[model samples]
Target: MKYVMVFFFLVLSILSCRKNKKDLINNKIIYNELIREAKQFYRLNDYSKAADKYEKAFKLIGGINNTKDGYNAARSFVLAGDNEKSFNCLFELTKSELNYDSYDYIISDTIFKPLHRSTLWNNLISKIKDNKEKNEKNYDKLLVALFDTIFNEDQKYRKSIDSIKNKFGMYSPQLKKHWETIHRRDSINWKKVKMILDEYGWLGKDKIGKQGNNTLFLVLQHADIDSQIKYLPMMKNAVRKGNAKPTHLALLEDRVSIKLKNKQIYGSQLMSKPDGSYYVLPIINPENVDRRRAEIGLNNMADYLSNWNMTWSVSQHLKMIDSIERKKNDIDFK
Candidate 1:
């Protein structure tokens, strides 16, 4: 599931690096559909079916050998009681493809815990450790540790939102206190991230690893507008250089747009009002926004909003847009 979440933006970079643009659009559509169905099967706990569909999608994008989703497929295979398939999938992954960051992704997923008991597991672990050592040999170890801290702390308070709400109710002082704590964490993270950027400009994957580099965007996106506005171009440049994810940039772009009271292009930004009801921010050409989203390798708008328990239908979108227009001052973010 984590790989499915991360695969979208990474696919864009892979597609761009490929030589053939011939029928690329058609292939992307097919790949996305397969991934969607694979996720559905995963949700239903049909691990065998999920693994099959996931492999098909991976094949379309040049196989799990080159993508992080290889780990996801392997995890599914293990869950489906096919240890051989999982080993083969991981063999492909460890072959000149994974980096230090990927090694962590492979080990940290608890589904792979059973593999540790196998005789072959030691061989795989050795190969993965070698990959990590080789790839991160030139990396700034200190910066990597710093970003790791920032990334972990960024979610520390946000993870408590649901529990706080459930225990004390929405808008209660306890929930409000939780948000205040979140803001404090965000501020501390922003200060560290800003200092890193000032000293190093923007760190690339080679220097900080993928998730470490993402700490820059995560902190900046949560920053005040002055901070977001300042680093926006730096992030765009990072995306252009294949150092950052397109989906990340699209999200930050929408966040900045909403902060400026302009329409969001990708429909990634939404607003929550005082009563806890949410509204989608006004999107430019809400009809074709999904196409725009796909252009940069985002899932369709419907899937992205599902986490909020919101549906994205033509009628529902129009109603939200209409309400945003009617109550201009009511929405805090818009």
Candidate 2:
């Protein structure tokens, strides 16, 4: 009878060890699978699937504490139309040692096209501290390289400019050809031109005007606060002039007031144009701080902004004039 009891104890110990081992192996598999699957979905632009896989992985890995996984998860969430989850994931990422590149990706990536001017987004701006030294160094290096390639071949640059002009008109008929000439005069002066646009409230218009329907928001994705401030006024003016729709303009106004400055005003005057193309102006504001918040707001605006004119703003017109001065050499478009 004593031997029988000892045998039973031994069996229980073995079973317990086996269970632990299986759990460990399974947890490892979940991590590996999630990472692999997330990459696959991302490559295909299947953000929804990628987000789900990432979420599952996060759970199995024990949560947002995993910085690399968290970063990818948040990015996937942005693509998946799950702004809340993306925001949470980004917030978690901020708590870790993620670098300026992470924050830069949030700011510059076109995926967050809709949320550039939100107050909630602005509130989160504190998360990305300035990396001026690094940014300047990087920018200088890239700019130098751009100039060396574009300086010797004026004709090559002219063709690129024409392509930009032709494409710009497809999305924004309002863009003037001369503006691109002015924007690219120095061959390597895009940075200065961008800064000038920002200072003058004409930022993001060039790129936005140049893209097609699918990439209209790409410019807005990089817009800053100053640019949004400049754009909202224009949108308001369009509304008051009866050039745009009240409903759509009102929605943008509401988002700006609530998510940007939280200032509210009621007016019967609205824009006469459709919101589809016009919405891109505000979305491109460089000061746009949070991808998730901006995306949520943009998606919501889509229903109302459908018919808006795909035209460029006055500032955008100016940028076209600026783009003509570029000197092309050998910089790969990629």
Candidate 3:
């Protein structure tokens, strides 16, 4: 009788644990769904609804885990004319580690321009600056600033290309000159990055600020394929040593694979159609792509693709690919 009672209790405990885990997953799904709706609202210019949805999702998650969503939430509230909520949201960010990591972006974002004149904004900036000063106390601040300068220059031309396109049009002489300028800068930046990597190795977020550390990847990403191939092994080792982010490594992997005309493992690469639609590039084992992405700390494919105004479903994608292949074969035969 005693043995049977112990066995029954153990079975119940195992079942209870399973139930709790399932419930946790379901809640996470719900939170992500809310965020998706919030982003959809923002895209549609319905700032009030976007703010409401973001607030709901944040409440469900207990607080902001990363600065991106919180920044979005604060911006939404500002656009919706809810100054109090916007202030509260930005205040919440100062309480997180993103305080130092996000200081530059938050300060520069034009969406927060309205809050700039207020006392609250001044206080927020003071707190964030303190966080940054504390974080950099033991590091070489000049080296950190140097990496930041490199990163800004690396991004300068790329960020301006869209505006230049609007002004001069694609394939125009002006655009050609712009590309030439960008390429020249890329060459200079690549040489600098190679020198740094050779001397100091991979400087991840811990050593440099987020943008500073990201300069390494950005420079190499803009370089020739040979440079990317050269650094792939080193980046892998950095990830193993906890000196780099696995998510960034996944993107570099996708870039190299796509350039080599091989299937990408994480489905991070996307190809655009002439009509302006986009589709994910070839992925290995489409059914398990999301599983692999999760292992590397990437979000769900559907959510990630939402940024590009694309919808994703592995089943739908596979079927579309099959249909296209069949049509191609029929035309070739004819």
lDDT scores for all predictions?
0.80, 0.48, 0.84
Indicate which candidate wins on lDDT: 3
- Against the true structure, candidate 2 has what lDDT? 0.48
Model 1, runs deviating above 4 Å:
1-28, 44-48, 56-62, 79-84, 97-101, 152-187, 224-226, 237-243, 259-262, 270-280, 294-315, 327-334
Query: TM-score-based ranking, best first?
Result: 3, 1, 2
In each prediction, how many residue pairs overlap at the backbone (N, C-alpha, C within less than 3 A)?
Answer: 0, 54, 0
**Backbone-clash count (model 2):** 54
User: lDDT of candidate 1?
Assistant: 0.80
Q: Over the stretch 27-63, how does candidate 3's per-residue lDDT look in tens digits?
A: 7898888888888898778999999999998888787
Q: Estimate the TM-score for candidate 3.
A: 0.82
In order of lDDT, best first, we have 3, 1, 2
Candidate 3 clashes between residue pairs 3 or more apart in a chain or in different chains = none
Q: Give the runs in model 2 whose Cα sits over 4 Å from its true position.
A: 1-18, 96-101, 130-334
104-170 per-residue lDDT for model 2 (tens digits) = 3356545565555555565454555343223334343443333323322222333344356455653
TM-score of each: 0.69, 0.34, 0.82
